[model samples]
Target: MFTSAAMFFNGAEEAVEFQCPVQETGLTATIEELMSLLQEGNSNSNSGSPNSGSEGSNGRGVYSLDERKRRRMTSNRESARRSRWRKKRHLEDLTEEANRLKMENRELKNRLGLVAQKCYVTWRENERLESESLALWARLSDLNQVLVAMQTMRSQY
Candidate 1:
């Protein structure tokens, strides 16, 4: 059982030999005690306690306090850099949209001016045609009266 427990921790298939006497009845209690001790050690290390060995010589495999702090600072700087890049990209997109909208507005205003000019020209032409039509109708009426008077004089003679 001790060999099995050690293999679980090691995550390997190679059989481990234990010299200590481990009874089946005490297995659960032993596992629990081991887990508690591991938790306590992790907490102490994270809290930078005196027993956690803040000195450069923490262990052969463990990182020193200064190294861990440097790694955390580097990760934070990278995260902040990425956030700033995203913000800059978003701002650039908004600026591009604003520029496009301004150009479109100017084009629409120019088209409106052209339409207004065309409408004024068409209105003046309509008014001139209407005045010419009235003048032609009055001339036709006077010519009809002259023709009727000539026919009456020819018939009397």
Candidate 2:
């Protein structure tokens, strides 16, 4: 029974060796090499032999389809997470830009309002000055007419 248990543990260790270990950065160099060998073997011989090259495979590679799928899923998840973060950042930037533009627009409008008010006040002052000038001219003309009349009366005498 002790020998049987030891044999079982050895089998488990061997099974672990037969499969590829998942790596964070895509596939490991060893797995990539094995996958290439497997592809080559498949292309060369479709003999459908039960045993070809390695212990579990037919002299090809130790590349497992499930392992490839799992790695792809992990990579895709990471890519999606990055994409979401980028989109969120972009939205935040746009929002900040919009707020800045709105503030600028409001400031410009205020400045325009102030300028318009100053222009109206200036126009009113100009109208008042024009009226005052016209009145002064009329008074001067009346005084000149009175002096002319007196001169003519003196000449007649």
TM-score leader:
2
Worst 10 residues of 2 by lDDT: 1-10
Clashing pairs in 1: none
TM, every model: 0.54, 0.57
Clashing residue pairs found in predicted model 2: 52-58, 52-59, 53-58, 53-59
Number of clashing residue pairs in every model?
A: 0, 4
* Per-model lDDT: 0.67, 0.64
Query: All predictions: root-mean-square deviation over Cα?
Result: 10.9, 13.2
Query: How far is 142's C-alpha from truth in model 1 (Å)?
Result: 2.3
- By lDDT, the best candidate is 1
Instruction: Write candidate 2's Cα lDDT for 1-157 as tens digits.
Output: 0110111112112322133444645445555666557655544443333232233525534334554567789999999999999999999999999999999999999999999999999999999999999999999999999999999999999
Candidate 1, 104: how far from true, in Å? 1.5
